[model samples]
Target chain A: MVKPMTKTKFLERLGAELGIPPATLREEAPLNSFKAWDSMGHMSVLAMIDAELGCEVPPGALQKCKTVGDLVALVGSKLES
Target chain B: MITQIASHLPRTVLANEGLAQLYPDWTAEKIFEKTGIRERHVVDEGECASDLAFAAAERLFAGRAREADYLLFCTQTPDYLLPTTACVLQHRLGLPTTCAALDFNLGCSGYIYGLSLANSLLQSGAANRVVLLTADTYSRLIHPQDKSTRTIFGDAGTATLLSKESGSRLHSFVLGSDGSGAEQLMVKTNGARFPRADGLPTTTDESGNVHDPACLYMNGPEIFNFTLKAVPKLVREVLEKAKLSLDQIDLVVFHQANAFMLEHLRRKLGIAPEKFVLHLEHCGNTVSSTIPLALEGVITTGRLKPGMKVLLAGFGVGYSWGGCILEW
Candidate 1:
């Protein structure tokens, strides 16, 4: 059985994918604020989530995520199911 | 055997700085860093695909113009809907009237498809000499304010000569399509389904890029995901068909979609940087012309040599994808 991903782990993974510092990835951090959060970054995040969580994050759903917490919650919900 | 390839780009150049003025949020450097494209050649007003195609074919001829047995012109943007562009080209290029010529509609995957058709024609003994031409003026089909499509597309034409040989260097091909993803990258209007008379209103997407219903619209993320899922499988299939491993191939030439997507696919496939052709910095995605343009670049630069095996892959715009191997 796979372990449930924690918020901290999710942030770390996303940070690595986006080339952002983990310390800067607070739950309230605005995703668009990061220079790396462009179209390519969005695709990389989706790939990272798929690789790390084994869940395919739809591009539409990924686009709906505005804050770091939203992304974590999106992945966490998918993980629960 | 594949004899020679020649490509022609429009004289007008659109640099990143010119695009930066349209999208103030992104600087020229940022655009270059993101797309790996510094500039693209765009056709001037009144120039069409056939003009570019004619120029490329003329260059390929260069006093060696001969009567081709068949002419294959591949493009989504034809000079006219009626009377195939190839027929016009045959007349314009001074090919014999006895030659068979036709137009096939495809986008980025066109070059590979053209090769497959040429190879088949040669194998079947239907044609001794095949002139495969790929050209597009996608710039005319894009909305001026749509930066997503505007920044990435360039106008170009390419002509490749194929002749029958007992030991033909052109080998296996793997082609695929997903029509369901057609809407993801398409011009919703000006087609049989949605006539221009319908007058669909121009709208803007979340990215601030405006789209006229007749203009080209690309869902970048969806296309990226589709490529990620399709290309590796396509590569593997071609390799399997050729009974060769990836390492055995001398070089991989893919459609010049953009720098970011190409880099991502390259890393995913574990292809060595030097073994991969990256020539699109000077001419953004030229739709059907990209692969042949890259092939010409590699040959001119001496990166590709005679007897070397090359893997060619092209994907986009039809959600069409194809891969093939050729011995240079």
Candidate 2:
């Protein structure tokens, strides 16, 4: 079974992917608030979630994901189940 | 066996800085950082994919077009719907009357599809020599204000020459398509099913990408999801059929969809970075030509040497996927 991922670790990894430090990544911050979170960044995050986490982020979640916490929850739940 | 590979990129370039200037929201460096593309070559207003393909073939031929016995052209952007572009190329390239030519429709998975077609003809002795050309101008199909596709695709053409020695260096191939994902990445209008409507409505999604029936539309996330599932399976099956292992591959060249996607896929597959080739930094995603372009890029640097075992995987557009092991 895949180990359950925590919100802290998710933030760290996502921060690294976007080249930002984990400490600065506010969980409730809007993804659009960051300059790095553009279309290309969006795809990179999806790729990272799959390649690293071994979890397929549902494509439709791209529309629903507005905050960093939402993405963390979506991916975290995928790994737990 | 495969003998020669050559490519042509148009003179006009759509650099990232120019695109950022047009969009205003995206900066040049941000565009380059994530996509790993600084610029992409685009065709002139009147130029076409066939022209690019012809130029590539001429580079390969060097006035020796008469040596070809078979021609295969792959494209979604054909020069015309009536006369096959391959027929036009056969004539323009001065191939002999005995040469047989035809066109096949595919996008990202095109080069190896052409390779498979060429392999059969060479193995069957139907032709002693073959000219495989892949060309596409996705720039022609993009709506002016569409930022997503505008930043990603470029126009290009590639020519790969293969001879009767296909039994040796050219190894096993695995090709598959799932039409269920067909609408995910396609051009819907101007075909018999959806004829072009003069006043057809165009819509824009949350991404600020405009959608018009006459233009090319790509659901990027869905395509990526499909690729993640299909490509690894393709690699497994191809290696199994070829009776080889991942460690045995000397080089790996996949379709250069983008730097970010390719890099992640390479890491996921555990292929070393140096072994996996990326050539789209200068050309962007040239659809069908991405494979051959990567191959050609390595050939120039002498990184792709003779007698090396190379793995090629192409997945996208038609939800079509293909993989093969070549003993170079």
Candidate 3:
């Protein structure tokens, strides 16, 4: 059985992948505010999510996410489903 | 067996700095970092694919214009739809009137498919020598203001000579296609389904790139996703058919789509950096000419040696993909 990833764990992993401090990733932090959040960065995020969370997130999913919390929720929903 | 290869790039050059002038938000450094393309060759206003193909073939004929029993020209941009471009090339190159010639319409994956066709011809005793030519002027199809396609595509032509030799070996090919994703990378107009009509409005996308129904359109994310799903299967199939493992292969050459995507594919496949061939910095994606151009680079640079096993794979435009192994 696969265990659901917690919000704390997800934030930690995402921060590592994006090279951001976990504390800096506030709930309402805008995704575009990050200097590394470009097309290549988006691909890295997708690859990291698949590698760490075992969830396949499409590129379209990232486009729909505006804030850090929204991205976490997207991945969490995929995990739960 | 591929005996000789020659390529021709147009004289006009479009540097990244020139492109930066069009899109102020993106600098040349940013563009190069994103695409690994510093510059691309652009054809003159009146230049066509046939013109470029003729130049490349002429270069190969400089030493000696040997007569070929057959000529196969691969391209999407032909001089005319009625008469085949290959037929025109035979006359332009001064080949015998008895030579057989035809053109195949494909992009990106055209090189591998051409090799497969040429190999089949030699094996079946259809032709003693074959001249496989690939050329495209995608620059002509691109809108001046469209940065997406403009930054990634360049104009080029390549000619490769294949002849039968004792103990020459070419492995079987593994090819695949999924037309359901065809629209992901295509020109919506100027074809049979959607003929070009005047007064078509131009629309701009979120990236600030303008597009007309007649111009080329590409969904980067969708193409990337399709590649991710297809290339792994392609690599494995070719390796299986050749009875070789990843470590046994000396070189792996894939379509020069972009630096970012090619590096990602290399890492995903666990291929070593030295074993992989990447030459897109000088000329951006030349569609069908990419593989042969890269092959020419490795050979000229002395990286590809005799007795080395090379794996060639191409994927894109038609959502088409193919793989084959060559014993050099």
**Compared with the true structure, what per-residue lDDT tens digits does model 3 show for residues B1-328?**
8888899999999999999998888899988988999999989989989888899999888887668999999999999877998998899899999899999999989999999999999989999889999999999888888887899999999998898962446785999888887887788887787787467788986556788879888777667767777898899999999889999999999999999789878977889999999989989999999999999999899998989999999999998988899888
**Residue pairs whose backbone atoms clash in candidate 2:** B1-B165, B1-B166, B307-B328
Each prediction's whole-model lDDT (CA)? 0.87, 0.86, 0.86
Instruction: Please give, for residues A1-81, the per-residue lDDT of candidate 2 as tens digits.
Output: 234566677788799867788999998888877766755667778877786678876646765789988887777665433
Lowest summed lDDT window (length 10), candidate 1 chain B: B163-172
Would you estimate the TM-scores of all the predictions?
0.91, 0.90, 0.89
The parts of candidate 3 lying over 4 Å away from their true place are A1-44, A47-81, B166-168, B197-201
Off by over 4 Å in 2: A1-3, A11-38, A58-81, B63-65, B165-168, B198-200
Worst 10 residues of 2 chain B by lDDT: B163-172
Q: Which sections of candidate 1 miss by over 4 Å?
A: A1-7, A15-38, A50-70, A73-81, B166-168, B197-199
Docking class of 1: acceptable
List the lowest-lDDT window of 10 residues for candidate 2 chain A: A1-10
Q: Which 10 residues in a row give candidate 3 chain B its minimum summed lDDT?
A: B163-172
Tell me the tens digit of each residue's lDDT in model 2 across B112-162. Answer: 899998988888989999999999999999998888899999999999999
TM-score of chain A considered alone, across all candidate predictions: 0.83, 0.81, 0.81
- Candidate 2, residue B12: Cα displacement in angstroms equals 1.0
**Clash-forming residue pairs, model 3:** none
